[model samples]
Target: MKRINTLGAGCLARALAFSLAAGGLALPLSAQAADLPAAVAQDLYENGGVEHWLPKAEKGDIFAQYVLGHMYCNGKKVEKNYELGMRWYRKAADAGFAPSQLAVGTMYFQGQGVERDRDEALDWFTRAAEEGYARAQSNLAALYLGEKGVEPDYEKALHWYGKAAAQGHTVARYNLGMMYAHGLGLDEPDYVAAYGLLSPLVENGHRAADELMQSFLGEMDEEELVAARELSEELQAQDRMLVALDQRAANR
Candidate 1:
């Protein structure tokens, strides 16, 4: 099946980088307590409430700036103008907005509105990742893993995956689980860790993730299966606790 790219050039592009880095395997996010990025909020304003936000986007507001960028980039509400999209995204990204940096970076990566430049893509991803943008971290990790714009390094891949994983990015968790399951990065195979990472996503209705997890586990014996199941139970409990904590945090 053709993978459904995430909305906008920013988040989905980051996921594309992760997909390439992890050799086109599944990657999951770990849940986190964080506010939406200004660019994302801008997206909502434009797409969610166009009448109210269109003028704001046209007036150089950072949130609206990005919404205008997406509008021009995809020609959704206005004339399709790569130059306009590029112009707006540059403004926001230059102001140190992480998502805008990523959005512009994706354009460079794909040569959508700008020249295709892997070097530029690296620059943008690095900027966003340094800001603790999980998608950018995953994307950077993929670049390292695939040697796309830099040297191939499994260790670097693990490092970035861990970064995104900590933020509850599904793709990062899924890739980390696969790495543990296959003994690709760490010293020994770690089915326990794999199950700990994956079971939550499978239960969360990620069909592709569920299939991948099942296939990976197919090699295990009955004993291993039982252990994995036990691990799943433990992870589920932990997930429940995490959810409770998240609710409390939000309430606070």
Candidate 2:
């Protein structure tokens, strides 16, 4: 599994959570935290499948517009068409949909539907991120990490990651754990802190987080290892509680 920059799963998790929460949809939190694909598929079906929404997208229903853009961008129930995807994304973004803004910015950065323009992407990402879009916050963290269109700024990366991580974005947690483990930003490596941040994801079978935790834990003393294990157990227990609460809520 790719250790670095494999934050797509984490990003998706936060985005869906924020979207669903904002829309007041009841999420069955028993759903695996790391299962982005299943969550997204369920979301799409619930929001009205591609057929019911695609025509609305053409007519500029902002949510439908964004979903249609994503569908074409990622070939969900439709042939991938970057140009059409960008067109739809831009329409929604221009109408002030934060998610669409981030999507358009990502396409620009990756040259998916437009020419690669890191600077332009950064500008758009900043706007969405500042408005508290978790995906934008995570992507902005990456830009800071990579020093795109600016100097390398570990502090900025940490700041943005903290924002996303607060919303339970796993990759942000992973990156913050790495920062703690590597003694970045003049802070000493703190395995206990890293473990606390990563344990939930690791318990959820996040491959990269698990690998990184093992490697990082190898450097800690036995006492630290014990502490880490205890922290992990607590996180797992918390996850179970969250699941139980979801079930209870559903029954109510």
Candidate 3:
């Protein structure tokens, strides 16, 4: 159903951008070594624990390099050194660690360790996204949506967002829902699709999703509401099946 000029000026786009940015997805980390207790490592990390991991990082341990980079970037176990952070992140990224690639992309995006280069950020994010990293996919979508230093491209944004959303990325789900709700770049709004995308988020206590759901419900008539509810159930079932399939594939 197309609702012409129903949304306030830039309202939907701004909401989508704010929700994505506010989600605050953390940088991914590799699993801790089975031999090394998580508590001990956490204690070390919080209390200048870089000494234990520095040797390993120097010896080309990707996990150690990532940890060291994170510590350096946040000044946890060492003085804040964005250059060293970038160096360590790059080492892991070059070794094909998806998390480190995402981190490096973020560094480039924020000008933390190097010049702020949107192109560099795009490159790193693309590498990680190609490897099926959901955060990187979402970030790449955001970049294409013009949240970073790039012109907005709705088609590219939708492609990347769909990838991330299929992987259960919360921010990407919210964004994709809003895009459907407002027909941001599409010829017509799809309220049923928006409902399907957003219903689970509202159930899970996402404030933004809840607000958007309220707005959506307020705008629809009884017939549309019934149709949206039915569509939402179908979408949820499909999502469950996909997750099950992914789990089975991972176990193989």
lDDT of candidate 1 over 103-146, digit per residue (tens) = 77777777777889988877987887888887778777767766
Q: TM-score ranking from best to worst?
A: 3, 1, 2
Every model's TM-score: 0.66, 0.62, 0.79
lDDT against the true structure, per candidate, is 0.62, 0.63, 0.71
Candidate 2 local Cα displacement, residue 1, angstroms: 34
Model 2's TM-score against the true structure: 0.62
The true-versus-predicted C-alpha distance at residue 134 of model 2, in Å, is 2.5
lDDT of 3 by residue, 1-252 (tens): 447536664766566553222211232232322223688556544544677888988999987887788778867647889999899989999999887887888788778889998788789989988988877788788777777458888777777777888877788888877876776656666666678778988998988887777776777888878877766675575356335323422543
Cα RMSD to the true fold for all candidates: 10.4, 10.9, 6.2
Give the per-residue lDDT of model 2 (tens digit) for 129-183: 7877766787677667653455557777767776777766666667766665554
Clashes of 2: 0
Best of the two (2, 3) by lDDT: 3
